[model samples]
Target: MNTLSILPFFRRLAGTCRLASALLAGALTLPAAADALPLEKIALPPGFTIELLARVPNARQMALSPQGVLYVGSMRAGKVHALPLDRDYRPGKLRVVADDLKLPVGVAWRDGSLYVSAVDRILRLDGIDARLDDPPAPAVVRDDLPKETHHGWKFIAFGPDGWLYVPVGAPCNICEPDPERYATILRMRPDGSQLQTFARGVRNTVGFDWHPASGALWFTDNGRDWLGDDRPPDELNHAPKPGLHFGYPYCHGDAIADPEFGRKRACDEFTPPAQNLGPHVAALGMRFYTGSQFPAQYRNQVFIAEHGSWNRGRKIGYRVSVVTLAGDRAVSYAPFASGWLQDESAWGRPADVLVLPDGSLLVSDDQAGAIYRIRYAGERKASGIPQ
Candidate 1:
């Protein structure tokens, strides 16, 4: 065949190969439109690129240890996972460290042990890094949490003050639950002693992290459902001290009072959100950008995984977003990566975000059962502020 005739043949072959690759990547989970390296559909800022790192079923919260093991927690899968990273920061084979537990969606590593949060208790795997192939049976650290399954899954982490922070979500959608217990963020030592309420009036907080510079705690709070599509906004909250209430059950967002419970107290009775997010966006798993791989402008900013809205008529979120902070206030909140939802059909749901030591970002998608790495591959500069 002449050169012109063969050109069309090569193009057809290339397209066929691409389609097959996408199907094989997510055949078990996502639709064919969002598989393999369909990352092309994903949008990021200039100089940034995203690639697949690993696949972990039901990946929720993520914690990276000093030795390069990335521990992930799950809810529906009821398991805890460990993914080792090579020196170049690529993910190795995944290992399920623990399985068949109740909503084990929180994992934190301290010293040499891996701490996991089940529905009603906290468990620990001693020396978990040294026993990936044959992890020891989890030992119960504390087992006195509430037994209610509604909003029971947790996202846990170690604070700067050496306390393991765990959130106990309200058992119901909206109610006058005891502030001392339900709708509270609790903190305890590694041995699960001296447990006390860190913050109150949190309906359901699935993610939190201390500020890199000031050590102030910040978190994402999901708004109550049935409040209509645009009534109450999901919150990015700032809790620098204990006993601050973020206005759950009685108030929401900056000053939107709860209709059923707001009569008991004014909206000013509690602390307001640092930034008001989209209504019913289901924001979860946030981290501060403290690495050097990205530009200096990204330092100390917040990275959030919006798992997307299931209740809204027009779907929103389903992407990783960045919140720029000036001092203690959020100056801007914008999308860092998006396009998981296309034509009202979502193929991937971003569950959590983690910053690697090399400064690349890791995003976990429970719906797609995959983890993706976002890296800066172009010339780096620190001149412009994020608009």
Candidate 2:
């Protein structure tokens, strides 16, 4: 049978009742028809070209194992997928590793195991690299997380400290919930013991990374909505130590006090953002460029995936952005790739970015259901920025 023809049957055979129901209901959203690669439409700084790496259904967060296996998780599809690559770094067959999960949007691979987050729980697939064809059942690493589904899907990573860092978003758009359970970033041992809040007062942060040189944590925060189009901007924040609070319900980027809750606390009580981004941009995943394939200037800079705006009258941030840093401060922010949003109609929404061992970057588009590889093949230049 053709590869496309067998997909539905494979899903039926592998999925549980709930996943099958979601499939039958036609809930797996896909992108519209576009030409192959469509690289012409996506504007990038010269010397860089983006290639389609794989087509994963509802591909969200991505994790690459030490052995070169690419694992992806989905939110609406409730599934986790694996793509084994060939020697050329091209993808092989796509396999469903786990299904029937609850908003499994985060994945992390470490020491021969794959960890997936599903709202209230964390599951691990042991020795997953060796069993792509027939994945083993996932064992529960932890099941004590809050079960709220509103902004509850997590983005997880193993920090430089060797602990698993997980974010629990505020249950509402702007609510002062319990500090310990909501609007906080939590870190725990790999075995799920000794869970503690790392940071607090964060409304929602779907992406973060540690500085390559300083080892400090930097994260992106989506500003609360309904404040018009230009009031509060998304934030790029720095947390050099634990116990720091990035303003949430009380204060927004910089000293912009929230209209409703601003009276409760002074804006100076919380740490301000390192840099403020466009309002309603829905900034998601971010990574500091540690690859040598790009020019020297691109080193240690941050790349962010802007998932685009949902409530804005004019759309913004459907592509990747670069933030320049100078000793813990964001000096500048600009676009690295655009044209995904043409006249307010977006053909793609970037969800996450990952750097491969070869110094190339891989970006996941959940709306387009695809992953793209960006490589720098140009000559020795001054910078990767578009002139």
Candidate 3:
């Protein structure tokens, strides 16, 4: 059946309950004509092109398998979607890898296993790609995670060190959370062993990536809201080593003291952000451009998805930005993708960005429930360069 025909059945089969009710509410908040949406609505640079990769409800935090299958984890839908791709990068087919999950938001594949993070627990499915149609029963890798529904959904990634990194966001807009709760980055073994706090005071960093050259962990932190339109800016931070602190609650932006959490402590206690990504720009997933297809200037720069803002009177973000670095310092910033928010009154939210093997970038827009592929066609080279 066509995707449109299958959506209604899926919606009914999803059952009528509180979670389903919430999903319905969220769906209603979306644009009325979701199918008519085009990539042009999401602005990008001149030479770059955007195409819808797939349509999956509430898709976020993507992970790709070795064979190039895109695995998407959902927040409101409580399922993981496996999207099949042809050799040319066209989305060929799609299937539900796992369902009935409790607001699963993070997904990762490692060592022949798939890891999923829900609000209160972490689950593992061994040999996932081999059993995409009928995934095996999951094993609880870890439980007792924070149960707070708001801002508790995770974005998990397996670092180069073979440890799983997870973000625990502050449950509220701006508050001094419990010690075990928000504003921290946690790392643990694949089996949920050796849990440790890698960084502290990081407020709602939904996306992060390890620098390919320096191995330092760089993350994008969303600033606290309700503080007006442009006081405290969102941050792009670089943690050169573990145990570092990226200020939050107590301090924000460069050295602006928090209106609520500010105390006698010195702002110098924490490492300031490498760059200030404009105020209220709900920055999410980040990835270093390591692919060779883009211009040489694009290499190693950080691409961040700014999910945009709501609480502010004048909205910002809603587009992706590139953060350039020079020897561990943010040298410059520029917009890589735009138009997601349209006229500041309208809406489209980009949640994540992933670099494929072919040097193309795949961006996920959760508000529209679509994934867009972006590729750079060199202006210097013509369309038909004779071999």
Global lDDT of each model? Answer: 0.89, 0.89, 0.83
TM-score of 1: 0.89
TM-score, every prediction: 0.89, 0.89, 0.87
Model 2 misplaced stretches (Cα beyond 4 Å): 1-37, 379-387
Q: How far is 87's C-alpha from truth in model 3 (Å)?
A: 1.8
Tens-digit per-residue lDDT, 1-387, candidate 2: 589999998787777776777868978633433324454688888888777787887888999987789999998999999998776787888899999999999999878999999999999999888888888999999999999999899999999999999999999998889989999999999899999999999999999999999999999999999999886999999999999988889999999999999999999999999999989899999999999998888899999999999998788889899999999999999999887788878878999999998899988989878888888987312221211
lDDT of 1 at 338: 93
- For model 3, residues 1-387, the per-residue Cα lDDT tens digits are 588989987787776665678767765343435354545565566677666666777878899888878889988889988887768877766788788988888999898888999978999988888787787888899997888877788899998899999888888888888745578999999999989889988888889999998888899888888778886888999888998877777888879888777784568887898999888888898999999878788899999988888787878888889998887888999888887766665456889999998999988888878787778874311111101
lDDT of 1 by residue, 207-317 (tens): 898899899999999999998988688899999999898888999888888889999989888999999988888999999998998988899999999999998889998
Better of 1 and 3 by TM-score: 1
Q: Model 2: which ten-residue window has the lowest total lDDT?
A: 378-387
User: lDDT at 92 for candidate 2?
Assistant: 86
- The true-versus-predicted C-alpha distance at residue 229 of model 3, in Å, is 0.9
